[model samples]
Target: MHSILPLLGATSLAGASVLQQALINPTNQVLFGSYDSKPLVSSEALEAQITEKNLRKRAEDLFSIAQEGVEEYNHPTRLTLCHTGHLATINYIYATIAELDDYYEISNQTFDAVVGNVFEYRLVLGDRQPDSVLAMSLTPPTPDKEAVFGPLVLVANDGCNESDFPATIKGAIALIKRGVCGFGDKSALAGKAGAIAAVVYNNENGSVSGTLGTPSKYHVASFGISNEDAQPLIKKLEAGDVIPSSAYMDAIVQKTGTTNIMAQTKGGDQENCVMLGGHSDSVAEGPGINDDGTGSLTLLEVATHLADYKVNNCVRFAWWAGEEEGLLGSDYYVSQLSKEENLKIRLFMDYDMMASPNYAYQVYNATDAANPVGSEELRNLYTNYYEAHGQNWTYIPFDGRSDYDAFIKNGIPGGGIATGAEGVKSENEVAMFGGKAGEWYDHCYHQLCDDLDNLAYDAWVMNTKLVAHSVATYAVSFKGFPKRTDVKMNDVSEPSIYHGPKLIM
Candidate 1:
């Protein structure tokens, strides 16, 4: 068993002594026997163990960790890759798993990854300055430490086409709406039109953040602003006002190291393992309580309850880092694995954004040809569970947006659930799940307001129960489950255009 001493190093001697007493109990000691000693856990029993109180406590803890980062950095943070809050989050998960040292093997997988670090970003329009502006990735910052200043020019449509920029737009800054194309495309179009810089504003209520997919010579310094902040400037430009604007962004894309936390049951069949995970890091916008905190904590909570019983197949839980920066951590882990190691993983399940304010029980639709052979079975597991519970469910496509991208591409079956993000709730969805129509499923998705108040408790608990049910079912048997065949690496081509939620390109 790994030592928990490191976690208690900062505690008072008396508190340390008490914890030591609690850990030394005979039941907590590792047994040197075979796997037959403990009885197998059932889905119903495991699901019963999940509670709203425990889930909320962990959510509160994550929220507090984000707040601590805010205090330490004196600004908002999303537990960005290898940052203070992110490291703290890794420590918290490690410590929690260390407490159950007798039942699981815990380790940290560290690897190199590229992440964008923003030092300073500012957007000025006339006398008004927006409080939040997200710097688009893979684009160069302003040159010579100078802001790109010019007269604001509103694009014809979404700035996806060359025709959107008039010939008179030279030396001006193009103001584009969020929909209809990739941020990179918009910036490239604006730059080709001789615009100095580009600003993409959200069409919805909250702030927006995205990437340019890859480096492009035609791309200019670009940033994303909120609807509230961009509406006034948009109206002014439409009303024939020559609004003066300036955009300055100081950021860098560099290679850095981060850790992925993994814990697996010691007694289950090691050759055929069931793996599940969620990204631990968040964007730089807010605490990311809902963006991924809910997913990470759900895995943690389920792992805690799982420690009490045995399983037929080894169950591994991962809290991945650098997911926000394009599935960096999970991709790196997959890349390092040998074919034998990859085959040992019978299936990989991912849970992200389990709780959205205007929640919909959406499961990953694994019927896409790109998905592995066994993906359909994995999808059925989740859908069947929801049906048995008399719950209304929908299907979401495998858009290669989350951690599951790596597993699916490697021909390993992958599927899971998410409430929603940035996507508007349809009236049909509203009738199924009670929330306002046309509003975002997670109004606070990747925003400053995604704190504890952002979570939907009822939905969180329901999805967490489903998580436990899946774990319990898969751990006991893969009786009818499809066998994983030798993996034929798929065409790992990058998407033509990359943007968040809705695709304009």
Candidate 2:
């Protein structure tokens, strides 16, 4: 039998055959292969090899590493790594989020309630808020204008048509129920009816503010109220009560900032690197635990464990900022890189939300028409992993909706997996994933309720394992994949910009 001294560092016959069997197995080939002279290494030799540590072990260790990251912020209860210069998420870039742009006060924004007039009113400012609140008296515009408001007129139904406005609505505020038509249409219709201002109460339970599509002469300052507050007023109005309320709005916009965290291995081959990351910031409402805490921590843990092993390629980890502000951080980083620098990256994998309470195993559908080449293999990596382990999985379209958007846009191959977000669970998904049907995969999405309790540990661990698997797999080899230098950057479109409220960090 082959000597066990070199493999195990001590000759012990008890496990020699098992070690010998492992050595002969080609599948167990280690990365460095310093101990692989005789075709394959023994189990003892392979165990001694860096590759034998396994992805699951590394993934499990992420819990503590993530905890360390969270604790670094001095928040023992929850980790909100927003707007910090934390190294855990920092990469090659050293600037903060606001520094990404120099013109027009890039990240500055400020808004406070308009003093006495601010009686819990939710105003819809479509993508533009004034730098300072300029109080304007509420009044109905003239006939040549869109709407009139003075004697408030209650629309007969959801304000979709001109007929909903009666003759009595002239020079009066139009009180309309929300339904049937878009908010802009209702506001414009009310404006046409000679209403001074449009008050659209939500059909649902929350306050609403939205766009009016495009600017029109008829457009008036529109507002929204929650159903709870509107119901009592609706009753009084039907009983012939005239409710007169006036409020002033003062909006302040300032240029402020946050940051993205990036960390890369100093040991691996810098010429060929693999990158992965998720957003580091959270919405202002609450600490985003499952949204990306899972993703960020996964990378940190992988990076931590990887420190002990040697690899053929470099691994860079990033925690993006302003992702909720429209993937601005990642976009800026990629834009700053030269064509030569961009080509240094072989691939990027984005991990956003990976632990929805009602989780569904979702692999990116790289086969979709929009995908760049080599995405199919990335998708196959995730799908194949889940399937091999007898786990159910599904596909989410590669719609340029995450941090991966910038990487793919510049022609780097990319793929990833997410448990899910605000998407509602289907009855079929309920059957497959064993969670409540008709509920959101993340019920607390973007809300203050998204705390540590929001995570499903089983799902979190599973997805992190997959992340480790991807990292280890790619770190070991890239034989079948195209090199970054060989592929020209595609003229890809930017990810669909979300003009809605910022819901991520």
Candidate 3:
């Protein structure tokens, strides 16, 4: 219900005039009926509105927002849930939608979220601080005057078990290998064995970084180091060298308030709405232009263009927050909805990382019987659009990896698409998508280099158009769409399958 008056002046008079006409007078009531009357928004027309130029403009805007935070916060990264960059991101999306208030009802849904912040972190071995040290998420912040100092004891196995820590681990910093268990388990086990802190080294190439899952009474401060950085330390330790190490960490995890921006078309069926969303916040590593900036902007661009015509079913867009920390915003939104409100939503679509440099047109495969009934229909909508356009696509699981988790768990049919993230491309995928087979789909998935240059413009545009086509199609009719069923809430005790920084195990 909140509106920003300044945004009204930002709209073009011609576009506003056309919007007025489209909403007040139309020909086809069966296909499209507005609050008043207007022409039905066609798939071709909506798709035509999605352009590379528009996408890049918004991408650049988002990148600058994150960059501004880097300069303001004087930190390596400040775009996550605990940073000012995220606040700015929320404001940006809100303003964009507020500008088109005439066509949509915009609101800010605020909620309390558990967010973490890292002020200072370091791990020094024998007077040398390695560049590969990364502070694990949810690690308890260090006191201002305290820094851990002791022998770096190499734990047996992955340090997932209490017995993995040797007798000498008392008052030491345990060095464990990353695998076999969650980081939280390793750190907790190390603490239980009398270690002050724990450091996990990567099992594979590249630097390791992840959450300890959540704050726990048993967990101690934890850090992740790269494989290369740990090899020499391990060799020296095995040679009976007491490698003196010092660790300093200053961070905190606490409850804070954040907002979810939502916009629904004023013209479509309010009783049977089509919803779509993407997380607006990035990780602490980088600006995350492709990680979700692509998804957020895609929603923005489509919503902007969608204002020009009427629809049969209401279309709603959401810019979710704190997805990297976990699915906080989306989950909060879903939790607040009444049973009637939940049933009002016909289906929900999610878009995340739409433009990986080494991309693939991967649609969410909602074929699992566990998925909500009609979830497959939502999947087919995107596949049909791709197939009609001669675009090659593959299937990815609806494993509750994104914001769709909340909706699907509530028995609302959910589906969407993503390019790829962190997953290595196969030779067959290279044959279809034409990228380096062994390399990550996005080398800069969660790194300092995930800037504007990281996006694949071609892939982004294709996916954006696909989004437009789907939105237009759903908005026009639900002829073949299934009716909402009384589905019981999914088991709450099951572990999360989201690909957020948290370890799945």
Candidate that scores best on TM-score: 3
Best by lDDT: 3
Each model's lDDT comes to 0.78, 0.57, 0.79
lDDT of 1: 0.78
Per-residue CA lDDT of model 2 for 55-99, tens digit only, reads 233223322233333333443112222223222223212222212
> lDDT of model 1 at residue 156?
86
Ranking by TM-score: 3, 1, 2
- Which regions of candidate 3 deviate over 4 angstroms? 1-35, 75-83, 119-134, 142-147, 152-170, 175-182, 200-208, 225-245, 489-504
Tens-digit lDDT string for candidate 3 (80-99): 45346777677677667666
Candidate 3 total steric clashes = 1
RMSD (CA, angstroms), candidate 3 = 5.3
Per-residue lDDT tens digits for candidate 1, residues 1-505, read 1222332222122111212222211244533244466557788877777778777778877776676566545654545553667776777777777776467888778777767656687888787777667777655677665787888889987888999898867888788888766787888888889988888888888877777655567878888889998988888888898998888878766667778888889878998899999988887768888989999999988887777678999999998888887787788788878998898888899999999999999999986356677788888888898899889999987777788877877778888999999889999998888899999999998778888899999999999999988899889999988787787643233452332232323
Candidate 2 lDDT for residue 48: 30
TM per candidate comes to 0.78, 0.59, 0.81
Better of 1 and 3 by TM-score: 3
